[model samples]
Target chain A: MVLTERAREHARALVRGLKAARIEVVASVPDQWIGLILEEVAKEGSFRSVPVAREEEGIGVCFGAVLGGKGAAMLMQNAGLLSSGTGLVTLHLLHQVPLLLLVSYRGTPGDPLFYHIPKGVRTEPALRALGIPYFLTDAGKDLTAQVCRTWTYARESAGPAALLLTADLFAGEDVYP
Target chain B: MRTSRVAYMQVLADLVVDELVVCGLGASARYWKALRPRPENFYLADSMGQAIPVGLGVALAQPARRVVVLEGDGAVLMNAGCLSTVASTGATNLIVVIFNNDVYEASGGQPLPAAPVDYAGLARASGLALATNLEGADAFRSALQKALKEPGPAFLCLRTAYLPDEPIPAYDMRPLETRLIFMQSLGVSI
Candidate 1:
């Protein structure tokens, strides 16, 4: 999907914020909604952009980066969060490793993808079930703050934290053909 | 013509100096623990098929220190997608060694019915720099030496016979404690 200027700017700011926060690795499995953000993150050149085949693998990759004295973040859609459930619980949650997950809030109302609805509804509940603290946002400014907060909480609690990006955030973006 | 698992590990322990090791849960982890009990060795307790991904991350982060993933055949099969992921990252300082035993020895010797996979061929197809399947200890040792020195996202498949005679010792420390110890050893403040 093509990014709206507003969405592009927002993505840039979030990327810059993550870089400023010293996130050295960005592991991702793309979703159309978060594609621009991941693209922007990849262009920055400061972080090691890892494109993973499975979202769960990103969790392992991110945790490994953290162990190697680097901060890491995972970018994916809500379905990825579901796919990564085991890794999140067994590795990060069980070992108390700090991880930052930037997940797209797919299937939220106003998104007509249809299939994403089920996961969208269950995303928050799943996060809560796993005891992961999360912030849902559509505004870029709020995302910046949420990113900072999530990272802080992850380190402080020695657990994983998440930032959920809503579909409304990219309302004006064009879908890729 | 399968190599003894202990012999393979002994060769690995001798070859793996200053490298961070992620041992997949089950026999591979047990073998690694028995061979090398250092803080640099991370014995994964239960996260199957994740050892390679974790090793990939470490390799990317460090870029200089070699990161080795010692995984079992069953574990690798469960998350074979990791090979593609690891290849995509193209980390030069990474090496994945799969212990191919043809069965899920951990789950009580249940045969893996998913058909046989040629791991070295898969790694080559996945774009790793070096890939080989070794049947003898000498061949494995030689290959491992080259794999260590060469720039790589190297892959090695060591055909192994499962001998369940020795019991894997239970790790007294919690997973977090083990992780902290490993990280702290690397001088990363928890």
Candidate 2:
């Protein structure tokens, strides 16, 4: 499914876009596809990756980091999104905090984990409920533009945005191996 | 240690040597529902167990102020894994005060597994210094006051009661916005 290649390409594109925008101080919970990009972001020495224990906490940290004159990004699974719904609704969204919320799309079409399916299928719907906007990366899409678009939306909305990455992006070999 | 939650907040506000991060569900949110004067910038509602870590990040970012986290039992239990990081990190100026009532009161008072779990012991196990579980207002005041005086990355578990059917006080987001605006005005950053 070209998962690894797509994920790597998307990750690199996101880093480049964020760099071009002079955005740094990203925060994220550990995830699959974003791990490679996070390592890259770390190695670039431009982004200070704040490792958070939960996705919701990541939002609060991101808010604080942004107010401290740095932009932030977040990565977690779709279920993590559900787990953080309250924070997103009240604090991040209501308070108008901007950041990228990249969600690894597990339990989608061919997800192996049985439990994640419900939230996986509800990702977009859930985002809609929280007034969050989101986009996704496919192997064939313009990865950099998509990343930049999500970042721009996050900036303009003054709230959170999501970039959903498919499993193939992580499993693919070219970038993250 | 203090008698009421409001009193605890008042003490913390008076002794709150630093900025604050408070997280909880519906019931706990009521603590700040009335919004007395304080330095806390709470990122609450829907997110439980996230305040301490948020406070940790704030501590790392702005080390000058003491960062206090006002957390509830259910909230703290949800992300109890975070306590280890709190203990292991460079948060010399952080404090976590847990208002433990022994149930998921926000979700209708179902007994939490934390009922059997000694959170203060767990905090000690997580390598936190000054971990103690206390009940009653007097114990809260003495313990909390002493805790404030010491140099610490401390944890205090206050076993309080079901916040009785006190009507959910009316709260407006304006107070919070005012604090944010005030912080911005003071060049304190959000």
Quick one: best TM-score, which candidate? 1
After superposing candidate 1, which stretches have Cα over 4 Å from the reference? A138-142, A173-177
TM-score of chain B of each: 0.94, 0.81
- TM-score for all models, in order of appearance: 0.95, 0.76
Candidate 1, residues A82-138, lDDT tens digits: the string is 888899988888888899999998887756578988998899999999899988775
Question: lDDT per residue, candidate 2, B1-190, as tens digits?
Answer: 3345665655555555445545444555556545543445553555566667666666655566666677888877778877876776646777788887777766667887734779899999988967898767667778777766666787888777675564545444553473375346336542
Best by lDDT: 1
